[model samples]
Target: MEKNKQPKLINPAELFDPGPYGFSHSIAVESPSTMCFISGQSGGVGENHVLADDFKTQVQDALKNLHIVLQSHSMTFENIVKITLLIVDHNQEKLEIWAEEARNVWKSSFLPTSTLIPVSQLALPGMLFEIDAIAVKQLAN
Candidate 1:
Protein backbone atom coordinates (compact mmCIF):
# COMPACT_ATOMS: atom_id res chain seq x y z
CA MET A 1 0.00 0.00 0.00
CA GLU A 2 1.30 3.41 -0.92
CA LYS A 3 1.41 6.07 1.78
CA ASN A 4 0.48 8.91 -0.52
CA LYS A 5 -2.88 7.61 -1.65
CA GLN A 6 -5.78 9.60 -0.20
CA PRO A 7 -9.50 8.97 -0.14
CA LYS A 8 -11.93 11.27 -1.95
CA LEU A 9 -13.68 13.65 0.39
CA ILE A 10 -17.24 14.64 -0.44
CA ASN A 11 -19.48 17.37 0.86
CA PRO A 12 -22.78 18.17 -0.84
CA ALA A 13 -23.26 21.74 -1.92
CA GLU A 14 -26.78 21.82 -0.57
CA LEU A 15 -25.72 20.77 2.87
CA PHE A 16 -23.97 23.14 5.19
CA ASP A 17 -20.18 23.08 5.24
CA PRO A 18 -19.08 20.61 7.89
CA GLY A 19 -15.53 21.86 8.26
CA PRO A 20 -16.40 23.85 11.33
CA TYR A 21 -17.95 20.68 12.78
CA GLY A 22 -14.63 18.87 12.27
CA PHE A 23 -15.69 16.35 9.61
CA SER A 24 -16.80 15.69 6.07
CA HIS A 25 -20.05 14.16 4.93
CA SER A 26 -18.38 11.11 3.41
CA ILE A 27 -15.19 9.70 1.92
CA ALA A 28 -14.76 7.43 -1.09
CA VAL A 29 -11.91 4.92 -0.99
CA GLU A 30 -10.48 3.38 -4.14
CA SER A 31 -10.29 -0.33 -4.72
CA PRO A 32 -7.34 -2.68 -4.05
CA SER A 33 -6.60 -0.83 -0.87
CA THR A 34 -5.63 -1.83 2.65
CA MET A 35 -7.51 -0.38 5.56
CA CYS A 36 -6.11 0.09 9.05
CA PHE A 37 -8.57 0.11 11.90
CA ILE A 38 -7.24 1.75 15.02
CA SER A 39 -8.81 1.16 18.39
CA GLY A 40 -10.02 3.98 20.55
CA GLN A 41 -7.21 5.98 22.16
CA SER A 42 -7.58 7.97 25.34
CA GLY A 43 -5.47 10.46 27.31
CA GLY A 44 -4.24 7.94 29.87
CA VAL A 45 -0.52 7.26 29.56
CA GLY A 46 2.53 5.89 31.41
CA GLU A 47 2.57 2.76 33.54
CA ASN A 48 -0.02 4.15 35.94
CA HIS A 49 -2.35 5.11 33.03
CA VAL A 50 -3.33 8.45 34.46
CA LEU A 51 -5.78 10.73 32.65
CA ALA A 52 -5.55 14.51 32.71
CA ASP A 53 -8.03 16.33 34.92
CA ASP A 54 -8.83 18.80 32.15
CA PHE A 55 -10.94 17.91 29.10
CA LYS A 56 -8.87 19.92 26.62
CA THR A 57 -5.68 18.33 27.89
CA GLN A 58 -7.13 14.87 27.50
CA VAL A 59 -8.26 15.72 23.95
CA GLN A 60 -4.79 16.86 23.01
CA ASP A 61 -3.14 13.78 24.50
CA ALA A 62 -5.57 11.47 22.75
CA LEU A 63 -4.73 13.04 19.38
CA LYS A 64 -1.02 12.66 20.06
CA ASN A 65 -1.56 8.98 20.80
CA LEU A 66 -3.52 8.61 17.57
CA HIS A 67 -0.68 10.20 15.66
CA ILE A 68 1.78 7.73 17.17
CA VAL A 69 -0.31 4.83 15.87
CA LEU A 70 -0.61 6.43 12.42
CA GLN A 71 3.11 7.05 12.19
CA SER A 72 3.78 3.41 13.06
CA HIS A 73 2.12 2.52 9.74
CA SER A 74 3.63 5.41 7.78
CA MET A 75 0.27 7.17 7.49
CA THR A 76 -0.72 10.75 8.28
CA PHE A 77 -3.96 12.54 9.01
CA GLU A 78 -4.65 12.88 5.28
CA ASN A 79 -4.80 9.11 4.93
CA ILE A 80 -7.55 8.81 7.48
CA VAL A 81 -11.01 8.20 5.96
CA LYS A 82 -13.07 7.89 9.07
CA ILE A 83 -12.98 8.59 12.79
CA THR A 84 -15.25 8.20 15.78
CA LEU A 85 -15.03 10.53 18.75
CA LEU A 86 -16.39 9.74 22.18
CA ILE A 87 -16.79 12.54 24.66
CA VAL A 88 -17.66 11.92 28.30
CA ASP A 89 -19.62 15.12 28.75
CA HIS A 90 -20.35 16.41 25.28
CA ASN A 91 -21.20 20.11 25.09
CA GLN A 92 -20.90 23.10 22.81
CA GLU A 93 -17.72 24.26 24.54
CA LYS A 94 -16.09 20.86 24.34
CA LEU A 95 -17.22 20.52 20.75
CA GLU A 96 -15.54 23.80 19.89
CA ILE A 97 -12.33 22.66 21.54
CA TRP A 98 -12.39 19.34 19.70
CA ALA A 99 -13.10 21.06 16.38
CA GLU A 100 -10.24 23.47 16.94
CA GLU A 101 -7.86 20.65 17.74
CA ALA A 102 -8.99 18.74 14.69
CA ARG A 103 -8.48 21.73 12.43
CA ASN A 104 -5.00 22.16 13.85
CA VAL A 105 -4.20 18.61 12.86
CA TRP A 106 -5.86 18.54 9.44
CA LYS A 107 -5.20 22.13 8.41
CA SER A 108 -7.14 23.42 5.34
CA SER A 109 -7.58 20.11 3.62
CA PHE A 110 -10.87 18.24 3.59
CA LEU A 111 -11.41 16.62 6.98
CA PRO A 112 -12.18 12.95 7.42
CA THR A 113 -15.63 11.48 7.96
CA SER A 114 -16.37 11.55 11.65
CA THR A 115 -19.07 10.61 14.13
CA LEU A 116 -19.15 12.21 17.53
CA ILE A 117 -20.82 10.31 20.33
CA PRO A 118 -21.73 11.67 23.70
CA VAL A 119 -21.09 9.08 26.32
CA SER A 120 -21.76 9.08 30.02
CA GLN A 121 -18.35 7.58 30.69
CA LEU A 122 -15.52 5.81 28.94
CA ALA A 123 -13.74 2.50 29.47
CA LEU A 124 -11.33 4.11 31.92
CA PRO A 125 -12.57 5.96 34.98
CA GLY A 126 -10.79 9.26 34.46
CA MET A 127 -10.90 9.21 30.67
CA LEU A 128 -12.80 12.13 29.18
CA PHE A 129 -12.15 11.86 25.47
CA GLU A 130 -11.35 9.05 23.02
CA ILE A 131 -10.81 8.81 19.26
CA ASP A 132 -10.56 5.91 16.84
CA ALA A 133 -9.79 5.97 13.12
CA ILE A 134 -9.85 4.04 9.86
CA ALA A 135 -7.12 4.78 7.37
CA VAL A 136 -6.65 3.56 3.81
CA LYS A 137 -3.69 3.09 1.53
CA GLN A 138 -3.70 1.92 -2.09
CA LEU A 139 -2.14 -1.45 -2.77
CA ALA A 140 0.07 -1.92 -5.79
CA ASN A 141 -0.66 -4.76 -8.16
Candidate 2:
Protein backbone atom coordinates (compact mmCIF):
# COMPACT_ATOMS: atom_id res chain seq x y z
CA MET A 1 0.00 0.00 0.00
CA GLU A 2 1.23 3.49 -0.81
CA LYS A 3 1.40 6.39 1.56
CA ASN A 4 -2.06 7.83 2.22
CA LYS A 5 -3.66 4.70 0.82
CA GLN A 6 -6.81 3.76 2.64
CA PRO A 7 -7.29 0.29 4.06
CA LYS A 8 -8.74 -2.22 1.66
CA LEU A 9 -12.01 -3.74 2.69
CA ILE A 10 -12.26 -7.25 1.27
CA ASN A 11 -15.39 -9.26 0.84
CA PRO A 12 -14.29 -12.51 -0.72
CA ALA A 13 -16.19 -13.71 -3.78
CA GLU A 14 -17.06 -16.95 -2.02
CA LEU A 15 -18.30 -15.23 1.11
CA PHE A 16 -21.52 -13.30 1.18
CA ASP A 17 -21.49 -9.52 1.21
CA PRO A 18 -21.81 -8.27 4.75
CA GLY A 19 -22.57 -4.65 3.99
CA PRO A 20 -26.29 -5.13 4.36
CA TYR A 21 -25.56 -6.57 7.79
CA GLY A 22 -23.42 -3.55 8.76
CA PHE A 23 -19.89 -4.94 8.23
CA SER A 24 -17.25 -6.30 5.93
CA HIS A 25 -15.53 -9.67 5.90
CA SER A 26 -12.07 -8.25 6.41
CA ILE A 27 -9.87 -5.15 6.05
CA ALA A 28 -6.24 -5.01 5.00
CA VAL A 29 -4.04 -2.11 6.06
CA GLU A 30 -0.38 -1.54 5.33
CA SER A 31 2.11 -0.02 7.74
CA PRO A 32 3.49 3.54 7.87
CA SER A 33 0.18 4.38 9.40
CA THR A 34 -1.33 5.37 12.70
CA MET A 35 -3.85 3.02 14.27
CA CYS A 36 -6.26 4.44 16.83
CA PHE A 37 -8.07 2.07 19.15
CA ILE A 38 -11.08 3.87 20.51
CA SER A 39 -12.68 2.74 23.73
CA GLY A 40 -16.24 1.59 24.04
CA GLN A 41 -18.68 4.43 23.60
CA SER A 42 -22.16 4.25 25.05
CA GLY A 43 -25.20 6.34 24.28
CA GLY A 44 -24.64 8.62 27.22
CA VAL A 45 -24.96 12.35 26.51
CA GLY A 46 -23.50 15.38 28.30
CA GLU A 47 -21.50 15.54 31.52
CA ASN A 48 -24.32 13.96 33.47
CA HIS A 49 -24.09 10.79 31.28
CA VAL A 50 -27.76 10.50 30.48
CA LEU A 51 -28.77 7.47 28.39
CA ALA A 52 -31.67 7.13 26.00
CA ASP A 53 -34.29 4.46 26.63
CA ASP A 54 -34.64 3.22 23.07
CA PHE A 55 -32.10 1.07 21.21
CA LYS A 56 -32.18 3.03 17.96
CA THR A 57 -31.51 6.33 19.70
CA GLN A 58 -28.75 4.77 21.70
CA VAL A 59 -27.11 3.37 18.57
CA GLN A 60 -27.28 6.75 16.86
CA ASP A 61 -25.85 8.57 19.84
CA ALA A 62 -23.07 6.04 20.27
CA LEU A 63 -22.03 6.45 16.63
CA LYS A 64 -22.01 10.22 17.06
CA ASN A 65 -19.88 9.88 20.16
CA LEU A 66 -17.48 7.61 18.31
CA HIS A 67 -17.19 10.18 15.52
CA ILE A 68 -16.39 12.84 18.11
CA VAL A 69 -13.56 10.71 19.42
CA LEU A 70 -12.26 10.07 15.92
CA GLN A 71 -12.43 13.78 15.15
CA SER A 72 -10.28 14.51 18.19
CA HIS A 73 -7.56 12.48 16.47
CA SER A 74 -8.14 14.29 13.15
CA MET A 75 -9.83 11.26 11.65
CA THR A 76 -13.30 10.31 10.47
CA PHE A 77 -15.45 7.28 9.71
CA GLU A 78 -13.52 6.49 6.55
CA ASN A 79 -10.44 5.77 8.61
CA ILE A 80 -12.15 3.06 10.56
CA VAL A 81 -11.09 -0.50 9.71
CA LYS A 82 -12.89 -2.46 12.34
CA ILE A 83 -15.59 -2.08 14.98
CA THR A 84 -17.14 -4.09 17.78
CA LEU A 85 -20.70 -3.67 18.88
CA LEU A 86 -22.20 -4.74 22.20
CA ILE A 87 -25.94 -4.84 22.27
CA VAL A 88 -28.02 -5.54 25.33
CA ASP A 89 -30.78 -8.08 24.84
CA HIS A 90 -30.15 -8.04 21.13
CA ASN A 91 -32.84 -9.31 18.77
CA GLN A 92 -33.91 -9.27 15.14
CA GLU A 93 -35.48 -5.83 15.36
CA LYS A 94 -32.38 -4.45 16.99
CA LEU A 95 -30.25 -5.99 14.27
CA GLU A 96 -32.33 -4.36 11.58
CA ILE A 97 -32.06 -1.01 13.29
CA TRP A 98 -28.31 -1.39 13.57
CA ALA A 99 -28.01 -2.31 9.90
CA GLU A 100 -30.04 0.74 8.95
CA GLU A 101 -28.06 3.06 11.18
CA ALA A 102 -24.75 1.67 9.97
CA ARG A 103 -25.69 2.05 6.31
CA ASN A 104 -26.66 5.64 7.03
CA VAL A 105 -23.25 6.40 8.48
CA TRP A 106 -21.13 4.45 6.02
CA LYS A 107 -22.05 5.44 2.47
CA SER A 108 -19.36 3.66 0.50
CA SER A 109 -19.51 0.12 -0.79
CA PHE A 110 -16.58 -0.80 1.44
CA LEU A 111 -17.33 -0.86 5.14
CA PRO A 112 -15.40 -1.65 8.27
CA THR A 113 -15.36 -5.24 9.47
CA SER A 114 -17.36 -5.65 12.65
CA THR A 115 -18.27 -8.10 15.39
CA LEU A 116 -21.51 -7.83 17.26
CA ILE A 117 -21.93 -9.40 20.69
CA PRO A 118 -25.18 -9.71 22.47
CA VAL A 119 -24.82 -9.07 26.16
CA SER A 120 -27.12 -9.25 29.10
CA GLN A 121 -26.16 -5.83 30.47
CA LEU A 122 -23.75 -2.95 30.18
CA ALA A 123 -21.71 -0.73 32.50
CA LEU A 124 -24.38 1.93 32.60
CA PRO A 125 -28.07 1.40 33.16
CA GLY A 126 -30.48 1.96 30.27
CA MET A 127 -27.55 1.57 27.92
CA LEU A 128 -28.79 -0.47 25.02
CA PHE A 129 -25.79 -0.29 22.76
CA GLU A 130 -22.05 0.38 22.81
CA ILE A 131 -19.55 0.65 19.95
CA ASP A 132 -15.78 0.60 19.81
CA ALA A 133 -13.64 1.15 16.74
CA ILE A 134 -10.13 0.69 15.38
CA ALA A 135 -9.11 3.30 12.82
CA VAL A 136 -6.04 3.58 10.67
CA LYS A 137 -4.56 6.65 9.00
CA GLN A 138 -1.72 6.31 6.55
CA LEU A 139 1.31 8.49 7.13
CA ALA A 140 2.57 11.04 4.63
CA ASN A 141 6.24 10.28 4.97
Candidate 3:
Protein backbone atom coordinates (compact mmCIF):
# COMPACT_ATOMS: atom_id res chain seq x y z
CA MET A 1 0.00 0.00 0.00
CA GLU A 2 1.08 3.54 -0.65
CA LYS A 3 1.52 6.10 2.11
CA ASN A 4 -0.73 9.11 2.50
CA LYS A 5 0.78 12.37 1.37
CA GLN A 6 1.11 15.73 3.08
CA PRO A 7 -1.74 18.27 3.31
CA LYS A 8 -2.96 20.24 0.32
CA LEU A 9 -1.67 23.82 -0.03
CA ILE A 10 -3.99 26.77 -0.42
CA ASN A 11 -3.15 30.16 -1.98
CA PRO A 12 -6.24 32.26 -1.75
CA ALA A 13 -7.09 35.64 -3.25
CA GLU A 14 -5.88 39.05 -2.09
CA LEU A 15 -2.39 37.84 -1.27
CA PHE A 16 0.72 38.56 -3.31
CA ASP A 17 2.11 35.46 -4.95
CA PRO A 18 5.15 34.05 -3.20
CA GLY A 19 6.18 31.73 -6.02
CA PRO A 20 9.17 33.77 -7.12
CA TYR A 21 10.67 33.32 -3.68
CA GLY A 22 10.18 29.53 -3.88
CA PHE A 23 7.64 29.37 -1.01
CA SER A 24 3.96 29.46 -0.41
CA HIS A 25 2.31 32.05 1.76
CA SER A 26 0.67 29.36 3.90
CA ILE A 27 -0.02 25.67 4.33
CA ALA A 28 -3.26 24.15 5.60
CA VAL A 29 -3.37 20.81 7.42
CA GLU A 30 -6.89 19.48 7.85
CA SER A 31 -6.59 15.74 8.23
CA PRO A 32 -5.78 13.23 10.93
CA SER A 33 -2.05 12.54 11.04
CA THR A 34 1.00 12.52 13.22
CA MET A 35 2.84 15.84 13.45
CA CYS A 36 6.49 15.85 14.40
CA PHE A 37 8.22 18.90 15.78
CA ILE A 38 11.91 18.62 15.11
CA SER A 39 14.51 20.41 17.14
CA GLY A 40 16.78 23.00 15.64
CA GLN A 41 19.30 21.47 13.20
CA SER A 42 22.56 23.21 12.49
CA GLY A 43 25.10 22.95 9.67
CA GLY A 44 27.79 20.80 11.08
CA VAL A 45 29.04 17.34 10.17
CA GLY A 46 31.44 14.60 11.35
CA GLU A 47 32.79 13.86 14.83
CA ASN A 48 34.49 17.19 15.23
CA HIS A 49 31.31 18.92 14.01
CA VAL A 50 33.07 21.47 11.85
CA LEU A 51 30.71 24.10 10.51
CA ALA A 52 30.70 25.54 7.00
CA ASP A 53 32.21 28.96 6.58
CA ASP A 54 30.21 30.61 3.77
CA PHE A 55 26.49 31.32 3.83
CA LYS A 56 25.53 29.08 0.89
CA THR A 57 27.52 26.09 2.06
CA GLN A 58 26.09 26.37 5.55
CA VAL A 59 22.55 26.51 4.19
CA GLN A 60 23.14 23.42 2.09
CA ASP A 61 24.63 21.48 4.95
CA ALA A 62 21.81 22.49 7.27
CA LEU A 63 19.20 21.24 4.83
CA LYS A 64 21.15 18.01 4.34
CA ASN A 65 21.09 17.44 8.09
CA LEU A 66 17.37 18.08 8.18
CA HIS A 67 16.98 15.55 5.36
CA ILE A 68 18.84 12.93 7.35
CA VAL A 69 16.56 13.47 10.34
CA LEU A 70 13.44 13.21 8.22
CA GLN A 71 14.66 10.07 6.53
CA SER A 72 15.20 8.41 9.88
CA HIS A 73 11.49 8.90 10.57
CA SER A 74 10.39 7.44 7.18
CA MET A 75 9.67 10.90 5.89
CA THR A 76 10.99 13.23 3.20
CA PHE A 77 10.87 16.88 2.34
CA GLU A 78 7.22 16.44 1.35
CA ASN A 79 6.47 15.45 4.92
CA ILE A 80 7.70 18.81 6.13
CA VAL A 81 4.85 21.24 6.71
CA LYS A 82 6.69 24.16 8.15
CA ILE A 83 10.29 25.26 8.50
CA THR A 84 11.77 27.82 10.89
CA LEU A 85 15.10 29.22 9.78
CA LEU A 86 17.50 31.00 12.11
CA ILE A 87 20.44 32.85 10.68
CA VAL A 88 23.11 35.00 12.28
CA ASP A 89 24.20 38.23 10.60
CA HIS A 90 21.41 37.87 8.07
CA ASN A 91 21.26 40.10 5.03
CA GLN A 92 19.66 40.20 1.60
CA GLU A 93 22.50 38.13 0.19
CA LYS A 94 22.02 35.49 2.84
CA LEU A 95 18.29 35.47 2.22
CA GLU A 96 18.86 34.93 -1.46
CA ILE A 97 21.24 32.09 -0.76
CA TRP A 98 18.70 30.57 1.62
CA ALA A 99 15.93 30.83 -0.94
CA GLU A 100 18.16 29.19 -3.50
CA GLU A 101 18.93 26.35 -1.14
CA ALA A 102 15.26 25.88 -0.34
CA ARG A 103 14.39 25.80 -4.01
CA ASN A 104 17.01 23.17 -4.57
CA VAL A 105 15.55 20.99 -1.82
CA TRP A 106 11.78 20.89 -2.43
CA LYS A 107 9.94 20.89 -5.74
CA SER A 108 8.70 24.07 -7.35
CA SER A 109 5.22 23.59 -5.87
CA PHE A 110 6.05 21.85 -2.60
CA LEU A 111 7.80 24.55 -0.62
CA PRO A 112 6.87 24.28 3.02
CA THR A 113 5.57 27.21 5.01
CA SER A 114 8.54 28.98 6.54
CA THR A 115 9.67 31.71 8.91
CA LEU A 116 13.16 33.27 8.79
CA ILE A 117 14.59 34.61 12.01
CA PRO A 118 17.64 36.83 12.31
CA VAL A 119 19.58 36.22 15.46
CA SER A 120 22.78 37.61 16.94
CA GLN A 121 24.22 34.26 17.89
CA LEU A 122 23.55 30.53 18.09
CA ALA A 123 24.25 27.76 20.60
CA LEU A 124 27.77 27.46 19.20
CA PRO A 125 30.40 29.69 17.72
CA GLY A 126 30.87 29.93 13.92
CA MET A 127 27.31 28.66 13.41
CA LEU A 128 25.86 30.56 10.53
CA PHE A 129 22.56 28.80 9.91
CA GLU A 130 20.11 26.62 11.83
CA ILE A 131 16.84 25.10 10.69
CA ASP A 132 14.02 23.15 12.27
CA ALA A 133 10.97 21.59 10.73
CA ILE A 134 7.43 20.43 11.50
CA ALA A 135 6.66 17.22 9.61
CA VAL A 136 3.55 15.09 9.43
CA LYS A 137 3.72 11.44 8.43
CA GLN A 138 0.13 10.38 7.94
CA LEU A 139 -0.91 7.34 9.89
CA ALA A 140 -2.10 4.31 8.07
CA ASN A 141 -5.56 2.74 8.34
Error of 1 at 83 (Å): 0.5
TM-score (C-alpha) between model 1 and the true structure: 0.75
State the C-alpha lDDT per candidate.
Answer: 0.77, 0.79, 0.73
Collision count of model 3: 0
Q: Work out the TM-score per prediction.
A: 0.75, 0.77, 0.75
Candidate 2: count of backbone clashes, pairs at least 3 residues apart or interchain: 0
Candidate 3: which pairs clash?
none
RMSD of each: 11.9, 11.6, 12.5
In model 3, the worst 10-residue window by lDDT is 9-18
The residue-level lDDT of candidate 2 at 66 comes to: 76
Clash count list over all predictions: 0, 0, 0
In candidate 3, position 42 carries an lDDT of: 72
Which tens-of-lDDT digit does each residue in 19-123 have in candidate 1? Answer: 765765345455687566766777866445578999999999888777766765567888888999999889999999998999989985768999999999997
Model 3, runs deviating above 4 Å? 1-32
Candidate maximizing lDDT: 2
- Model 2 reaches what TM-score against the true structure? 0.77
lDDT of candidate 1 at residue 18, scale 0 to 100: 45
Off by over 4 Å in 1: 1-31
Clashes in model 1: which pairs? none
Worst 10 residues of 2 by lDDT: 9-18
Model 2 gets an lDDT of 0.79
